[model samples]
Target: MATPATTAATSAVSVRLDALIAQRLAARALVLAASRKVAADSSGIKTSRFRGRGVDYVESRAYQPGDDIRSMDWRVTARTGRPHTKVFQEERERSVLFVLDHNPSMQFGTRVRFKSVQAARAAALIAWSAVRGGDRVGAVGFGGGVTGEVRPAGGPRGALRCLRSFVEWDALARATQTASPLSEALERTRRLARPGSLVIVATDGFCADAAAQAPLTRLATHCDIKVLMLTDALELAAPPRGRYTFAIGGERRRFEFGDGAHDGAWVEAFRRRRATFVDAARKLGIAVLPVDTRDELARSLALLGLALAARRGAA
Candidate 1:
């Protein structure tokens, strides 16, 4: 038998809570712009004729063996009697790749909505913002069998599709069957993107594989990887001593949740699976974004932006 209070709490935290989060996202604060245009620059500075990047003409040194022929300063080569290449730096187009985890466990969240819902929203915001910033935005959504696959679409329509695909994705998650491994999917993502591309990975960071560290390291080596490590606040926290038993549609189960701080022999055990996920993030140099559905999106976005900027500086 279960106490009325426990049952009430469980009932409140059921799947229906997701509806509330969706509603919050729908009722965005204000002035939500889905499109953006690049502004003309007139600082007496022009795109490099050779590189098309914002590279000022620095003095050219003798061309090294690996120097690109395309960058060869023909005039300098003729006068200096030695091959020399112009150097240019990129001041433009930021390509961003967003990876989403549509895993079964993500389908569950104890608070407002599922972590999947939050993950989708975060991905959508980043995708839209990237496109808005004149950066190409692409997404690879998987979990219930690779729901949406769009590769760095450019323009307002592309951003809209990113949002729409997220909203339209089937809510069902497949916990069964031979699902794709994160490693293979990561490899595929690497193939689609080039170095210096921003890769945002959204996942609970849990896989059945015994060795999760290796693949993540490999992923980091190829791209500027940022991890949106998703988890519920409560799940990450060790709850007060308690127990739960429940029945749903017929099947019944029980769980013990607590921190054994109540007595010397009692052991406090919150899943703490998120700790392992965080470890993987640190090991792989991933930028972790802890998402709470109850938190405001604007605030979260600001936090993410600052975090990203710092990460970029460090990188």
Candidate 2:
């Protein structure tokens, strides 16, 4: 018989498409407003800093000194018998790309959900938020020898598409051994992301080694990048003093857990893995947010500041 904790853990090992889709409602709380640095063009809801010579005409105003002569509204000027210039807003739909990692390392969690599930939830919420903000949603998934890509697209269609892809990719993760490296995924993302796009990477940082640095640096130059560092309570702190048993490759092993030299080393290993990833991201001007498996989805989103305070460099 399975204990309640064991049952809960089993239930959360993977995510369902409906659960991801349901996040649309919760995503409304997310604030993805545009900042001055973000670009905009045609077919976008977020107002762009640029005005003249773009799609979505705002209105015609009386001609002013130094106004672009090319923007003169001949029809309005002819009707009003006064020189007028057409005002337009560049409404380019910004792209938000999610790079999700589902390596075997993320498959373990001692809390409400696996690290992989938490990552999926975070990505889903962000994707829906992006769509609500009138931005395009795209994704790249790597791990378990499976690679999935969804092209950038806008509105519910795009959000739903990405959600479906998440489910498919996650299923693959649960069934296969992880083979793709995080560096490879980042390189692929570098190619997919356009200038002025925002890329959100969801991973446990297990495979984010030195090899991934170059790709992240290049991507940071043109794209705004955010890292969701998926973590669990077990990984963040030392376990309670006790004897822990583990089964590896069909063999059983036991180890003593306590505030000993080895215990400190174990904790430090997890810290180093997290610090290395976070430090590199910060150095490149990328924002890093830690998401825990034990957190509720809404609370997690808030903590991540999916409100994106980082847009103003406040994070």
Candidate 3:
């Protein structure tokens, strides 16, 4: 039988509006980069080596083999008697989209908080950070047979709007009894997000299986992608050597862990799922952070900041 103390602790950590709102304080200290916009012809930020026509001329560079003929710096080429190409910088306006998964599976957690709640917390921090970084923030919250979207807008107002949507959509997920696949949300994201935007996905790996890969890959081709894979310790490994029992739907069920009979398969299933997600992310040059439910909010944010920093360095 579960103790009242344990139940109370879980209740306290359930998805709450106040808890997410408080993340505003941590947002100021986030180390995420100030995003750079990309024009229609470009596939990434202006900082990338991508060439395109833009509103402002940055410089003229020696013409490379693959340099676009349309960008030839005729004046520079004539003055220096050498082939040159114009490098133009795009105007600054960035969009950061958060794809939050609140499926029924995410509502389960044996730790301090549900995976859904943890996802909400992480999304809140990132959205707030995006606003602080002067990027327009938006979100697509899907689950519970409901899909909600808030378009990208700059400043605190946009972040606040996303927070409200998070709370409302999460409530719907908790109230409903259906599960929505991660692919559905990603498909919606594809339609909603523009090229060169940054897309952050927060979810438990339950619904992130093979079916979700196509849209993910397509989305990554055009935008910067970051993933927050929320997990519980129980999902990573079998419990200590013992027999644990629980009640489900008025029936008590027993589960044995640490026994060699099934522990390997149990652990391997999770490992395989995680590997698939990692493999896909890596193939698309995306950054991924596996966040444990046991981790503090600050730790998760710090890890995310570090991941983004490393990605920026690589770029």
Candidate 4:
């Protein structure tokens, strides 16, 4: 696979993601989920969304028609005469609130758009599905802490407001002019998230302490927390490091390009750090999605949604 540097650097970004509009990709399915919000309107169809998008394992029971054997609990099957398998559900329709971090760092992107743009696009898609599924959508914009909350509501109007707040993530952060705080973000999630909801958080992965993850667990007590880690393509694939100099927080530093002996060494180092961050989140049972640019959003979401749905179905 080509890294960001070797691929799509010059791809036309002419298609402006109207941060205001949801791109209607998978609109029909998204709408259908909304239609069956209450009264147990099971589409009789499982999400196909199995990759841990949302799930809670129920005990194994005797296998039945249409049940996928992949989820068979071998131990239970051995003990029971009839073939028994596990069951799982997609948690169900509820409000989804996006906690978007638009600190100064998120505004910088090595490619087509800033991390904030990617965050907005993903959030818009979620809001679209929530609207289509007849669930209320809400947004919490923050830089150093909770900046604003657009209370959850239903319908296209609710989705519009949600998208509007997502677009404002950058504007609000810039207005505050403060660096984001990790621990405080956790606290805010704890305070604001409600029971039985989806909480999607978008942030640059410069966290202070791993212990700050406690709030995520706490929020999980009431809601599902899926993390979107926004990073730059340049950060992922180190370019041929031509001479580069920059000032950071008043300190000026100059760095040299690869001296032949250490070609791509820094690139390896970055990949390790990125992988570590992802692994840590996985250990905590929080599903993490990495976003480097807006265009990648569609492919990623479709893949993720289908995977999660399949899991739900199999279970």
Root-mean-square deviation of every model: 8.6, 9.2, 7.9, 10.4
Candidate 3, 248-312: lDDT as tens digits: 66699997887786888878887776687778788888878888777776666675655444334
| 2 or 4, greater by lDDT | 2
Query: Per TM-score, what order, best first?
Result: 2, 3, 4, 1
> Across residues 120-151, which tens digit of lDDT does each residue of candidate 4 receive?
77777767766665567888777733377888
Error of 4 at 137 (Å): 1.2
For candidate 1, lDDT tens digit of each residue in 175-283? Answer: 3322445665575676677555788888876642435557667667646777777767656554456777756446898657564543322222333445565776786
Q: Give the clashing pairs for model 3.
A: none
Between candidates 3 and 4, name the one with more favorable lDDT: 3
* Candidate 2 wrong stretches, greater than 4 Å: 1-11, 31-48, 51-91, 303-315
Residue 246 of model 2: what lDDT?
88
The TM-score between candidate 1 and the true structure equals 0.64
Whose TM-score is greatest here?
A: 2
User: Over 4 Å off in model 4, which ranges?
Assistant: 1-17, 22-92, 144-146, 260-265, 268-279, 307-315
User: Would you list the C-alpha lDDT of every candidate in the order shown?
Assistant: 0.59, 0.79, 0.76, 0.64
- Residue pairs in clash, model 2: 40-92, 41-91, 41-92, 42-91, 42-92
TM-score winner, 2 or 4 = 2
Q: Model 2 scores what on Cα lDDT?
A: 0.79
